[model samples]
Target: MFFSPAQIYPFPGTSLAEDPEDIQKEVLENYAKDLPPIYLDVVQHADLSTLIWAPLMFRYPWNVVFGKLSKQNITVAGDAMHPMTPDLAQGGCSALEDAVILGRHIRTSFVQNGQVLVLKNLSEVLGKYVEEKRWHVTLLIMWSYISGWVQQGGSGRGMKFLRDAIFYKFLFLKMVKYVNYDCGKLDF
Candidate 1:
């Protein structure tokens, strides 16, 4: 059973004590104050002494716009290419999509060149891979961030209405439709 309480500021490494148990208790106490009754009840009874605390960090989609994903023949895929919030549960799926698309591009290039390994061809192959994945990855990042924001933004009445009534009813199906995306076969 895992629970993630959103929007907590990361604890500075220097402020952490040597004792992990103490840190765990302090973390739970500090963050558990705002949890709803159901979660608070679980926390109260759970043996959280062995609980592990890891920060969830992600770069906003806009920050990645101007960043270069490829340099010469080298490129990145998966989380390295698009680190997003887990709200959409698409991180690993997108990574696999990256792999299939990248592999398909590489296979096409290799086959066209008579299976010869050319340094210059690699540059184009990686560029194509990056170009193809850029928009898709950016959209995933944006949507995942928005989903996380909507689900955990605030507990106020208006926010609750927006989240529960509008988002869940109307937007959730659209958000999850990305799961139907087909990365296509690897065979050229």
Candidate 2:
């Protein structure tokens, strides 16, 4: 379900080792007060005893996440390359963009070579894909982090004021603009 203003639920790494049921119980208890009535109703009515959780993890744009974009014939994309908080709702969409762009690069290489793609050729092709996507992915990671921080309410009154004024008034549109990117054609 969607919440108008996003919510932040922090799970420290140490807590992740707990049993699923225990974790679920703890999460419900922790967010009980913050959950809206509609969500609480769904939880109760649907008997949400289990949670299919994937850690919503983030890494800086210049970290190992960026370092591993392309290495020889191997290239990272989607969640592997740029995992972000769910605030911007762009995680899956950006991954799809990566797949389409990667496929196009591979297909272009095959067409130009007019022969089977060998290891060296594949590395070159993958490198092209990485070059095409690296800056775009960096923007995504940075903006998505900002979007999450502002929407979920930051640590203090200053942040809260920005969230209420600047973010809502102007920043939301700018953030949405990122998601409207044109990936062009796969042409494969």
Candidate 3:
């Protein structure tokens, strides 16, 4: 499994002395029942005879933000103003859309006076960008989180069936149209 806590867990090149063979065996024995079973023949097990355990272990955290970056100062872009989940993969696309709209607004403001104007002159444009795109990004993040929660829920069976049958097939597909967008020709 992948490392759960970056700081708390041992990483690559860490000494195996920390958790000796007995501890490792006990830990694996406890968790093996919780994990999905796998076949060793799925991959080349030629090296299995030489190694102590499996090489790859994926440990994904629940609802992790991972890292955050300051997205906006005076003028950066959309993601700077909003921080959300990577659920729908709109983090960058929405940023691109924001950049396009903001750039056009700045271009129009500059072109009107033949010179770059003050920050005060651009506040209205910036406000409009934030006002217009905030709700869209918020919805994207909310839905992404909800979907993830459902999929990774506690050994779900009935819920998963309902989600796959009703939401994923009937509802979620249409909601995805918000992310596959291009703002270039818009008159916003």
For each candidate, what is the lDDT?
0.75, 0.71, 0.52
lDDT of 2 by residue, 1-188 (tens): 12223223442223352565665666667756589988866655544445555555656678533476677777788887777777778889989998898889888888778756666888888888888888887778778877776666545788778888788889788878877999889774
lDDT of 2 at 68: 60
Clashing pairs for model 1 are none
Clashing pairs in 3: 1-57, 2-57, 2-58, 2-59, 71-80, 72-80
**Candidate 3 segments exceeding 4 Å error:** 1-78, 185-188
Q: How far does residue 182 in candidate 2 sit from its true spot (Å)?
A: 1.0
Per-prediction TM-score to the true structure, in the order listed = 0.73, 0.73, 0.54
Deviation of model 1 at 81, angstroms: 0.7
Off by over 4 Å in 2: 1-55, 64-68, 154-156
CA shift of 34, model 3, Å: 18
Candidate 1, lDDT over the whole model: 0.75
Task: Order candidates by lDDT, high to low.
Answer: 1, 2, 3
Residue 128 miss distance in model 2 (angstroms): 0.9
**Where does model 1 exceed 4 Å of error?**
1-19, 22-52
Q: Measured by TM-score, how close is model 3 to the native structure? A: 0.54
Q: Where is the poorest 10-residue window by lDDT in model 2?
A: 1-10
How far off is residue 8 in model 2, in Å? Answer: 8.6
